[model samples]
Target: MSTTTPDRSYEALSYEWGQPPNGDFQIHLNNGHSVDITENLAAALRDLRHQDPSLAPRPLWADGICINQKDMEERQDQVAMMSDIYRQATRVITYMGTESDNSTGAIAAMELYCEWWNNNGASSRVEMGSFTHEETIAIQKLLSRGWKLLLMCGRRTLAHWSLLSDFVVHIFDGDLKEGGFLLLPQSSHGTDTRAECIYQLALLRHKVQGRTISEECKLSWLLCDFQVFAATQISDKVYSLMSVATDVNIPIDYARSARSVYLDAAKKILANADDFTILHHSFPSQGQYLPSWVPDWSKWHYGTEFVVRCGHLCPSGSTRPSVRVGELENKIDLKGLLVGTVTFLGTPINDHYQRSSNAGERAQWVQQELESIKAHLNGTDPSLLMAECLVGADVFLDVRQRSTIGEGFVAHMKQPEAIIDDVERSLVNSFVTAVRRRSRYSRLAVISGDYVANVPRGTMKGDWVGMMNGGKHLYVLRKTSTEGEFTYVGISYVSGLMQGEILASDSPSEGRWLTLV
Candidate 1:
């Protein structure tokens, strides 16, 4: 009956608990008693029971059943042991909810599509003629679920699930994908771990990013990848992640505030890795009221639109970035850098709701957003701002070249007085091509003092964008007026302006660095 024997062979279920139905849903216990569970978990058990009839009443571990929900101490202990629980299991069964209206057909179509993709290669347009009427409908159903968006976007998966576990069922049965496919039933859990499906399902469509790079720590990866998942208890957000985390020594006290746990985790992660990778991955906290420096994993969207590539934003040819942490505390101090006052700020381009799925719609939004930036620039020459917009973040080839500049640019040192005509035109052409291409996933802009550049989602007009000596991307700084210090906004991938007046010339008179806390 004890699931924590450490040597027991059992199946661990990974599923989202959907909203409960009108009546009680109960699970039978060993003592000839039954306990209530979410309707979603009950549904999963029924399917599991039917799935392997041969193994009648197979030994399994379901969080809702195994952990005593009412006992805080037991819940914390079990939650901390989840990673080991999953890893030790003979199999980790992901319960995607049962088939809905057209789910069976949708799943079959997806399987066939996977087979075709495995045999052939990546193609944007699906060969609808190759499928039957039902298959077409299935594909449409899947597409309607934004499966297409999952294919195109950058995502991260649970490292343990991606690398350690072996899945039992092949929902999208086909050749092995790059990482592997994890077909989950539709549930609220999908909201947090849905990106995990991108690894399992979307691998068939596009080449998954970061498949090659070695992850430094599991906690960092979890914070970066699984920021969107929510937990009932705020502290569970940190506690539940203990299993897969390489550093488990961090305190897991349920009594402590989530902010304290997060701050402690950040401090530990920074100690292991000197680079500022975690800072960039952090998004603004969602209602948790944590410090700006602590990443609120509760939020779904990242701070910026651009994917913070590994070893990115560090100065050229440098493997290790210049970073230092507090001696015995959570505070981090960035070496002295420049600061600029907010002269002008633009309206938000992408808010929580207004994000457009269609490329054309996003381009239209970008155009309108640029027009708004133009209004704020007043009478200044629009060329520089336009060039920055053109060289927007995630522009692939352009970003690669712009991010690799080592010796700095002569034209940038003489900005306002001198401009690189050829580079400016190239950026202009890039911007025009982006608009025409109509692929507006990561291109975002914020305006300040006759300047516009690609910024993350939450970037505001008054935020200070400055250069750190070894940082590859511009560090967005927020002023703490009362404390007379600054906090990090996510790193900015402002194209073309990488070496401009904001970061260039080392003008001691023009820039000042306040202690970052």
Candidate 2:
């Protein structure tokens, strides 16, 4: 509420308010009166107030203090200005409050680790054997912290930083002598607010480290990361994110419904990005009224492993874009080419179950899923089928060799059974990169007379798999009761569809263009 000066600087605080546990504290105002503020903010203010005796009282902007929550208009205005407020501020302090028993040790370990990295250079894998027992324990505790776990979430590889927390949690439960790791329950402290802190802090850190972030990409990150950020009001998720979004420029409207705000944000993002990649990021929303394509940012959605976008079918500058979408009436108008119909399907490959840790069990489950798919395929040649299913099979194979699955290929095949097991493993391993992507909840759909692809859990046996004009990946389309109408069932990783199979086939009658809404 004060004017800025060149000599003066403000620091923004990003942390959880945590129920105002210490209750209220009095703050003296200019009118010689006092107002009550939460204990959390009071603590933060006290911390800042006592900070440097040499300097004047530093200006700080904490959301709980600066914005009047009772005033909706003021909240909206303040929320809209958040990006500017943070970006313009000299520093953004993330206050996790007083360190816990493990936290102090974790912080020390992090400082030492960073120092080591600075001197020794960066290595993707940490050589834990080189560290002292105390160092190992400290590192483990740090990795399991909410903020650290948030940073590791949705990562491409769960082998390093992501798995460190699990190792720490289950160190005594498993036989680490044989390189076996056990699953551990996720921390209760992994709140949406913690995720929000990680994302915002990491983003700013990226800039500090001299990484170039384009304007368009920030919106994508904001959209993806916003899903885990805590917000009291459903609409605030969108409103809070608007400031950070570069591509999506949605107006702050307190009158608008959360759905409307979300839909508007999606529209803006699509309009600016001109790709269906945004649409592919969708997961089922908790609110039934929310659009299936528009993600509900307030809730957690599993199986968000990054999709491998092979540049074959929808390669850059391919004359025809892979996806095209427009709004018609009250629904989104989508037009895409139907690659093929799913004549056969595999059982949902559940890799995330509690008992899925056993390698033999994992192999057996995969084998069963593959057998079902192959049985449905009948006598169809696997190569021809794969040719039809993938975009760049050769390229994908090359990429797989370098992936975590590929790195452990020999170990995975140690006790393999029938030929179908290897085939299924290879097929599943090719497109499915991470443990998260290989969900037991998601099934594999075999496009009739074309190729096999992976679809979300709810995909039916007869669901249609198509390629939106500018879409990066194949999409599952379910036919509605009404003729010619189809609903999008989320994006599918159809293996063979990407390598120009449509062009290779002489029979044009095999494929048809359908309008999706």
Candidate 3:
């Protein structure tokens, strides 16, 4: 083994370890020791070796090859140092496996787009229709590449793919003349602008570049964003992010169980976060081992579209969290007031409805769901309430848009035929986007006091809805067998209680401690 100085120049590799190839892909060291590596790593090594003729024998740092994965202590130490390793490297070479899925075309298309963008003064006037058919096809391929890479690595590592990252952010940040244009292929439901994912990437880049974000907020956001990424070992979900997240300090010990690592990470985040934003990421875990309060990063959850705090909806309202660690493992006590119990659950807005090509069918499904929720409220017209709940209380849209959309929703409910007009069409599009943002992996619920909520799918009729002190979103808690104890169902978006209405009447002192397991 050789030791290198801090000033030494080396290239750090960021890649997905795809499935192993058919043959045993092995490399021999100078000491004559053969080490097996994944097919993706082997491809990356070959690409790095021949990228430049004169840069032969370039010093490289690849996690699979350099880190002693078999040794728990060494793995932990190496992982802790990964952040500095990537930051100090001459450049980060991100290899997204061998170029399949028309990746070459995607790269070419990106170059073309960048060239066009630079020539056009980065104007919002440049629409997707301006591109030729061939160019559009290439752009679609490029977007597919972006989504694949994003799902594989998450946003933090996307910055390494400089060209694609910059291009996507530029498009996302551009102020279009009208509504934004679609960059990806047109969905059967018409051209739905898949800008949400791009917007997230752009937002992350902006925050990181601004350097004004707190370490706590940064770590919390990073953890939320990283939940979608896949990893061979579930613990790596937390450990892999150790390099990018400056605030989190959980030990990267593979010797620990996945649940243990997840629990420790959750505890650390909750303790340090400025608000209860981390709780928004928690969902019902399929496994019994993980506590309901802790997030299971291994399993994918869909309601994250509404997780971002917008500084408006403060259910807990200026109260700091009163959290105490329980004497028993996998248990915590939090002080908060119960908003109400869920009295009715509307049909879940499944993925099919969200991805449906028939706009009429999708709209009808949403309308029926809303009508069902309204029926439960004793024929009380919940037009605005339903609108607010569906779109997450205007968190994503501006005040004017929210008003217009809310009015459109009322009109749509009154006369479904009028939606064919241009204005109404635009309204339907906005409504669809809003529903997609909040409703995926969730269902509409009617709580006590006739309040409506956008709750996680698993929320039952009897689940208790409460707001943790300093939390932006209300949480759904299920009663446990033990008295005065509950298990977390998930976060919820309640219409009336979202704006601190409960806090206005009930003081923080009135809140009681509820144990969560």
Which candidate wins on lDDT?
3
Q: lDDT by residue for model 3 over 1-517, one digit each (tens)?
A: 2325756688878787778544579778998897788887887777656545776578888888898767879888887887788778887766665555545655666666666777886444566555566655655655654343341221122323456555665654543333234455554433433444545555566667777545443566777776666787888888878777778777677778988888888777776667776677776655638888887878755446454445477878778888887567788888898888989888776453454445556567667776888788999987788778877866877777876867656544433444367777667667766677667668888999899888888998889998888787888999999997999887789988887788787766678998888
**Model 3 error, position 453 (Å):** 2.3
TM-score, each model?
A: 0.66, 0.74, 0.84
Regions of candidate 3 where Cα sits further than 4 Å from its true position:
1-4, 20-23, 51-56, 117-199, 212-218, 243-248, 307-311, 350-357, 362-371, 411-421
Order the candidates by lDDT, highest first: 3, 2, 1
| Candidate 1 global TM-score | 0.66
lDDT (C-alpha, whole model) for all candidates: 0.52, 0.54, 0.70
User: What's model 1's overall lDDT?
Assistant: 0.52
Q: Write candidate 1's Cα lDDT for 1-517 as tens digits.
A: 6766766578887776667434488977678998779987887777766455576668879988888777878877787777778768887776656565465665545555555655675443343355566654543344334332221111122223222111212222223332122233334332213333444343322332444436433676666655545565767666777765765457667888777787788777765654555676665544556556667765555222234552323322232344466673546655545444344444443331121234344445545655666666674444444444433433433545555222121122232334448675344334443332222223345445445565544556577766664455666777776464677666665544454434354542333334566
How far is 84's C-alpha from truth in model 1 (Å)? 1.9
**Higher-ranked by lDDT: 1 or 2:** 2
Clashing residue pairs in candidate 1 are 96-184, 96-185, 97-185, 181-200, 182-200, 304-456, 313-472, 313-473, 314-472
Query: What does candidate 2 score on TM?
Result: 0.74
